[model samples]
Target: MDLGLRGKVALITGGSKGIGLATAISLSHEGAKLAICARNLEQLEEAAAKITDLTKGEVIFVQADVSSEEDCKRAVEQTFERFGRLDILVNNAGTSAAKPFEQVGTEAWRQDLELKLFGAIHCSSYAIPFMRQAGGGSIVNITTSSAKTPPASSLPTSVSRAAGLALTNAMSKDLAADQIRVNTVCIGLIRSDQIEKSWQRLAPELTWDEFAKDPRHDIPLGRIGNTEEAANVITFLSSEAASYVTGTSINIDGGKGAAL
Candidate 1:
């Protein structure tokens, strides 16, 4: 069951909370040194503390916005400087307003694309060098299932994530030649702060526990996914476990994609 990830290094975007935080903890527990980034220094520092408690792995937090080219470049550089190598890059940062297409403003759409899509692009551009230099590595992009199965009215974020899928597909071949594997992990309603806020806003009458059950009841398996579940898949994609898997999008959504 060992993923052979010991001594490896990773950089995760939006590592301050949710899936990103869980992935950081998971990989660290798997014995990987880590560097994670988020715009919120406080949250990033807190996440670093929790991961340090769990894995006792070398952890550093960089305060940066993934959408900015400068921040992405510095993040990769900081990882190399802190860990001396980069073995994995998890493009997990994203944001959206969950508004209808016509109702969504131009600025909101631009911001969503900038953070979710361009952020991945910027990170990949910088991280590729270290992966190339190290002779090989892995990149696991955290896109949403909405990209594949856009729920009734979530066009802006869906389109952005679709672009991410294309990017992940396109990078696989060229990167694989350098021993860098690239894959996309599509998410459903994994437990996170966003989901919590959504619950309060969308179903305020329901208790937290009751709200948690809503999505589970809706999905075939009758439950939403947890961060650990998603993180496990990410580590698999990053490690020797997924040696032959590349350019493939793995849905960690418990079969709620609606594509079948």
Candidate 2:
């Protein structure tokens, strides 16, 4: 289907790997110009190369840690400077920081909030003007299902993601007048770098497929989700295909999340 993404510019944070990289590639394939940012320059370069090689589309990489307000501003500025306009902003920069409530210290909570909550805020704030100038745009915030149905021992991550949900809802209402649509994807156990690290650390002896189907993850679909699966919904929300979708949260959890 024609998603009406051609010639549009998209900026994806944490785009160096995993779901963020997958989303960039998907958007590029739909003919969207991409500006992807991450803290690691090497990963950013590699991801840019991969996207360009696959889609032969315009892809720029920016090295910036989204947790910092200054870095978030710079990332948006560079995207606008490179593409002249920003059509989509995917706030995907974050890591899992789940643990027992008591185990999460003040610094840990602060860092998690900074990266997941403030990161989205800073980027969206900076990107709004550009989106307004372009007439309209989309902001797809990447969150987790834990925000809605946090399990035992889920601390900082759950709290931080809950704030993200609130942010998405509030931003959608505030930006709808400007034609800027805001939404979020509540992800589950998706295959990504972080998951890969967990596999290596927890059960390096088992094959990936074996580890993923270990039955402990409890995904109703009986397996973990792939990065592309998560990316597809994100691309749709960021495109004209979902032009009317806003202030909503979609769970890409393979039926793992208990709450709607």
Candidate 3:
């Protein structure tokens, strides 16, 4: 099961918690150096400590808001400066900003696009040349299953993620000549900090396990997914194990999504 990730360098946005943190740990376990960025320095420091404690691998934290183009560029530059190269770029910075179309104001829509869509664009744009210089690399964009099958009340998040899917496809084609592979993971309901907060707000009476197994979610797996489950796929895609995987999207939704 050698993923060929030893000594490789990866940059993960929004790596302060949840799937991003999980992915950073997973990659580090495989002997990959990591640069993770988030807006919150305290959370980023905590995440870095956790990863270092768990894997004892090289890991750095960058404080940056991916929504800002300059921040995205700085994150990549800092990664390259520290790591000497960039082998993987995981566009994992985003929030599930879902709401009814009528309820989502113009500013909310604009902000969603900036963070989810342009964030990926800006980071990848800066990381590409470095990847090309290194001979080849991988880019894994974190999207949502709703991008393919938009459910009711899923506004800007779905639209923004759909654009991410398109961006992944186009980038794969355009970067293929340079030996860079682009792929995306479409997430389902996964256990994370945000999900825990949601559980507390919506159903504090039920235990966490009870809330996760609620049949109302309709997850075919009979429960919500864990962060490591999603991270495994992302780590694979970011490694040589998925060298031929590109321009495609994988659903990690336990068959909850309607589309193929």
Candidate 4:
């Protein structure tokens, strides 16, 4: 199934590892030129090498923290400077800053919002003009399932992600005239770098396989999702295959989410 992404330029945030890295590889498989940004230069370099090795695709890595507006601008500018045009922007940079409702202080809330909400806002703002110049484009924002189905102890992330979903819908409407498509991929418990860290910290005695086994039973599919699974869906939304789709929040959670 050709996704019509050949020669298109894509910029993915938090592309150092996990879902972002997987998405970059997926898009590259569709023949898209890739630009990825992350806070850690070392990780970004490693990820770029891996993606290039797998797809033999052109990939550039930029070290930029998306929470900062200036960094967001720099990421977009760098991508455009190298690729000459930007067709897809994937807002996949964020962390799970979940805390109990009582523990979520004002500063915590502000920081999470800056990283998740404002990060997407800043990236899209910079990418829009270039996309318009290119005649059309796509923006895929990575959010969490908690945005739609609020669960206990899911703090700032839930609130910020819900805002992201709103932004996705609103931007889709506004950009539809420009031939730009906006969509969000709401995630569930996907096995990724972050989850690996949590598992190690929460249960140092258990091996990854053992730790994952417990939660696998909880998911309806009898297993957890992988980064590639989420990435496959994201690249679809970022390509012409989803030409008629916009303002939609699709869940990649293996039936873990309670809401529709």
Worst 10 residues of 3 by lDDT: 251-260
Q: What would the per-residue lDDT of candidate 3 be over residues 154-253, giving only the tens digit for each residue? A: 9999999999999999999999999999999999999988889999999999998999999998999999999999999999999998999999999999
lDDT of 4 by residue, 1-260 (tens): 89999999999999999999999999999999999999999999999999999999999999999999999999999999998999999999999988889999999998899999999999999999999999999999999999998888999899999999999999999999999999999999899877888788988798877776666347787666888999999999999999999999999988888887
lDDT of 2 by residue, 49-130 (tens): 9999999999999999988999999999999998899999999999998789999999998999999999999999999999
| Most lDDT-accurate candidate | 3
Q: Estimate each model's TM-score.
A: 0.95, 0.97, 0.98, 0.96
- CA lDDT, every model vs. true structure: 0.89, 0.95, 0.96, 0.94
Question: What residue runs in model 3 are displaced by over 4 Å at the alpha carbon?
Answer: none
**Is candidate 1 or 4 superior in lDDT?**
4
Runs of candidate 4 exceeding 4 Å displacement: 201-210, 215-217
Task: Assess candidate 4 and give its lDDT.
Answer: 0.94
Sort the candidates on TM-score, descending order.
Answer: 3, 2, 4, 1
Error of 3 at 136 (Å): 0.6
Please tell me which predicted candidate would have the highest TM-score against the true structure. 3
Say which prediction, candidate 1 or candidate 2, comes out ahead on TM-score: 2
For candidate 2, the TM-score is 0.97
Runs of candidate 1 exceeding 4 Å displacement:
204-207, 215-217
